[model samples]
Target: MEDVLELYEQPYDPQQPVVCFDERPCQLIGDVRTPLPIKLGSARRVDYEYERHGMGNVFGYFDGLAQFCGRN
Candidate 1:
């Protein structure tokens, strides 16, 4: 929307700071098999299959004016 875009376009001000916050539900996953170690010029190889261990909540906070971020 125009209102959201206009808010983002405003210059950063320390006193009147702009902050954004978001959260996500993350699925904890694990490999079915032990991954192959990395070799020269090659990266570690993972299996095509995975196992779901549990769920987790991820939160993010950002201050546009101070260019600061925090995560949990």
Candidate 2:
């Protein structure tokens, strides 16, 4: 909405800092076994096998006042 966008246009206010939050559901996966380490003349390798651990959530936070946001 226009109101949300307007918040970012205003000058930073430490007293009334604006913060946003979001989260994404994720499936957690893990390796079944230890990976093979690389040797002097050999290439490192990983097994094709994997195991599902459980469900999780990835969260994100943004600070409009500090102009600080992080994501890939």
Q: Can you give the TM-score per candidate against the true fold?
A: 0.54, 0.67
RMSD (CA, Å), candidate 2 to true, equals 4.6
Per-residue alpha-carbon lDDT of model 2 for 1-72, expressed as tens digits?
Answer: 999898878877677878888999999999999998889988889999999999999999877558654321
Candidate number achieving the greatest TM-score relative to the actual structure: 2
lDDT of 1 at 20: 80
- Which residue pairs in candidate 2 collide? none
User: What local lDDT does model 1 show for residue 9?
Assistant: 82
lDDT of 1 at 19: 79
What lDDT is reached at residue 68 by model 2?
52
Q: After best superposition, candidate 2 residue 31: deviation in angstroms?
A: 1.5
Tens-digit lDDT string for candidate 1 (1-72): 899779878876667778788999999999899999999999889889999999999999878546633321
Report every candidate's CA lDDT: 0.81, 0.82
Position 62, candidate 1: lDDT: 78
**Candidate 1 residue runs with Cα over 4 Å from true position:** 36-46, 68-72
